[model samples]
Target: MQPPDLLFLGFFAFCAGLIDSVVGGGGLIQIPALFNALPNALPATIFGTNKIAAISGTLSAAWSYVRRVKLPWALIIPAMLAAFVMSFTGAAIVSLIPKSIMQPVVFVLLIVMAIYTFHKKEFGLLHTHLVVGRREKLLGVLSGGAIGLYDGVFGPGTGSFLIFLFIRLFSFDFLHASAASKLVNVATNAAALLYFVPTGHVLWQIALIMAVCNIMGSLTGTRLALKHGAGFVRVLFLVLLIGLIGKMGWGMLR
Candidate 1:
């Protein structure tokens, strides 16, 4: 790629990291940007290269959140493990499934999520006490597995879904939910990379430059979330859901 193309993609990578760190729909930005910039590249190569940048930003955000937020380790640990395994499985089977099948389903789900969150004004505002038990752990694992599978197969809003699930299932506020989602995302992205890397799909030069830009953006976003707290994240979450809805709905229509 030329310098101009690298700069163009770097700009998008930074934006993706910023939005993704706060809410989890960064792929909605990064993936399309990849496809647009590298129009001649194989789809798998684009996805693999994107993962390199994504995982870098996600890891930075996850570490930042770990320092600032009080996460539920009991829930997150199982979820992370489950996400890793299931994401790997999803990546392996990705080619077997068609993207058309998943687009409308995600579109409808995003709509419902947006509507419910909009009506519930106090939703994701305050963290509830988590009671860790077998049932709760099972729920965590299942959620991780399901979302991870989706991420590996056709990831656009993995972070948004993870945050919503954390808030809805575990009664976590947006801030904590965002923080927790980062760790699970790290696992899922890493799992995808395991497949992509071995298959020689990554474009390392582009990915490395994008990773630097993404890390910078992720750190900036993490600082903002830690400063502003849950109410800020709640608003951004709703906004991201709308964006994801639009993206998915448009894809379905196309």
Candidate 2:
């Protein structure tokens, strides 16, 4: 790739990281940019590169959130572990099945999520902590495993889905949901990377540059989300969900 192309991708990564750190859906930006930037690369290679870049930003955001936000470790830890394991299974499955088949399903889900979130004006506004004891842990495990699998097979809106599930199932505010989502996201990304890196699918050179840009964006986003709180994150989440819906719908149509 030329220097100009690299710059363009870096810029997109920055934007993706910023939005992803706030409420997920960064892949809605970064993945398309990667496909456009490196048309010759194999799809798996592009996906792998994306994972490497994304994981860096995710880790940074996770750390930033953990420092400031009160994470429910009992729920988060189990979820992270489940996601880590299931992500590998999802990656393995992806090697056999084409991801195109999943796009329509995901597109439909995004629409439903957007509608639900929009209609519920008070959703994700304040932390409710409805789940407690074994039920909470069970829900966390189930959500993490399912979403983590999705991330490995067809990433795109993994973060958004995670945040939404956290809010819906656990009644976490957007900020706490986002923070917990990042932890699980890091696990899923890392799990995917374990497969991709060994299979020679990642372009380390480009991924390194994108990682730096992604982290920079993550830092800025983390600060903003922390400063503004869940209300800010909720608004951004809705906007990004709209963009995700459009992107997926367009991809399916085309």
Candidate 3:
């Protein structure tokens, strides 16, 4: 095991916490830092460590959002539970595949996601509902469960995917979609960590410290999102999506 690089790791965790709090792409900051700081560490350990900090930030942001916004529990509760279950299953299969395959796929998806968000002139943040029926529930479960599986297996842009699925499928405003995104994301992260922790992969001391910082960052981020509202979040979401694409693509290429 590599000795932890406290300084770089802590700083990266703090930045990740803040970004994750805002729009849900914290791995863009944390994962690379871990790789650079502990280049010799096993991939699973690094991923497990990353989850330790990330889930902390996500849960904090989730609670903050729940307190501030009227969460649609009727829809989100089952979604979260379903997501958690699926994430565990995905984690079970993660090591069987190489990440190289996702590179081109994620890159193209990112470009399309950005363009779609841009071209749809008058879209999102309107809290409109174009979906109704069993289809809406299926969309949530299918998308949520599928993405939850993806989160545990790959984990680059799960948040953006969730937001996009909600916006396109449910026609929800960006704010509400983000709020829902947090709940499901927390579940997936937690579920993955459950498998990781028992395997003795997590760095507990660092995870605890990072968790504290993550919660603080989450508080600040949630407040900012609330103050700025949906349009601002939509923009930030796009930016994070790009970062995720770049980071994942670069990692795959190298």
Best lDDT among the predictions, by candidate number:
1
- What is the per-residue lDDT of model 3 for residues 140-231, given as tens digits with 9 covering 90 to 100? 77777888888877887788888887778777788777888988999999898898898998878767766776777777788888899989
Q: Which ten residues in a row have the lowest lDDT in candidate 2?
A: 92-101
Candidate 3 residue spans exceeding 4 A from truth: 1-4, 129-133
- In model 1, which regions exceed 4 Å deviation? none
lDDT of 2 at 140: 92
**Model 3 TM:** 0.91
Of 2 and 3, the candidate ranking higher by lDDT? 2
- For residues 176-236, could you state the per-residue lDDT of candidate 2 as single tens digits? 9999999999999989889889999999999999999999999999999999999999999
**Of models 1 and 3, which has the larger lDDT?**
1
What pairs collide in candidate 1? none
| Residue ranges of candidate 2 with Cα displaced over 4 Å | 95-101, 129-131
Distance (Å) between predicted and true CA of 153, model 1? 1.7
Is 1 or 2 the stronger prediction by TM-score?
Answer: 1
lDDT of each: 0.93, 0.91, 0.80
Candidate 2 backbone collisions, by pair? none
